[model samples]
Target: MTPKRVLVAYGTKHGATAGIAEQIGTSLREDGLDAVVLPADDVDDVRDYDAVVLGGALYAGHWSRKAKRCAERNADSLKHRPVYLFSSGPLDSSAEQQDVPPVPAVAQQMERLGAREHATFGGSVTAQTPGLMARVLVRSGKAGDFRNPERIQSWAHHISAELATLP
Candidate 1:
């Protein structure tokens, strides 16, 4: 019996989304699956994995361009596999209030690729970041660390359970 291979691919600007992807990969591995975490741009083939979890940081209500392109380029292979999409953005505790909405174009692309699930998770913003805009956003009280590790773990657990039931 071979362990299921899962790919957790992500796109990040300040590394927040990458951290989330690593956590997901860790959780999946703990659940008895083989998981690899990689940058979305680094993955050129989805045919090597049994399942995929694609995520990206959302900026201005849009997923990272790299993630969008990854999906578009691998749509054909991804459609035949179990794929999940996640967006990490919004420095608010309330998921509903976050600016994590999937870009319309990206959402349509994911749908065409047959993604099974999509989730929006809270993100982090730091005041010491190099970008002036990021620093300003943090100083203006619109950004802070709102990531919920427990929630991320729970979602990963759910995915693990679902994968376990797959034929």
Candidate 2:
């Protein structure tokens, strides 16, 4: 059977979220779903997709504005399909679940999107990554990468299964 189409959209300041989205898109395709990965700002419409995966880099406990806008702009179509939200943040080694908490921005749009799943995964931060301002912030201990590959793959699996079950 021809697989359903899935759009994996993401916003990233330092490429980490983009990388995550790539992994997710690849995983979905591998599982026999037709997945297209693109930057959130680049998606013109969500009408063709059977499912939408929106992801963004987290800074100061917020998802990027573009990703948020994508969700808002496509709210009507998204509500009629399966939607998933993922955020990247909380890289401090000291954080477990209690320390990292949850993604607040995603929470605000969850009900509106009728999101089937929401995930908060660790992101990557390197000395060479981020722009000047972001680098400075990271050096100042205000920003960090908290991406987790295992958790990402797990989430991908669940989403792939969900798409498989779609009619």
Write the residue-wise lDDT of candidate 1 on 46-136 in tens digits. 9999999999888878888888888887888999999999988877877655445566866886779888888888888887555887888
Give per-residue CA lDDT, model 2, range 1-167, as digits (tens). Answer: 57799999998887988988998998888888899999999987999998999998887788888899888888889999999988876666433354344467788888778788777777777776847866786788766656666667778989998777778
Give each model a TM-score. 0.93, 0.88
- Poorest 10 consecutive residues of model 2 by lDDT? 93-102
Q: In angstroms, give how far residue 94 of model 1 lies from its true place.
A: 2.2
Give the best candidate by lDDT: 1
User: Which pairs of residues have clashing backbones in candidate 1?
Assistant: none
Report RMSD (Å) for each prediction in the order shown.
1.9, 2.4
88 Cα displacement, candidate 2 (Å):
0.5
Best by TM-score: 1
Q: Against the correct fold, how does model 2 do in TM-score?
A: 0.88
Q: What is the lDDT of residue 32 in candidate 1?
A: 95
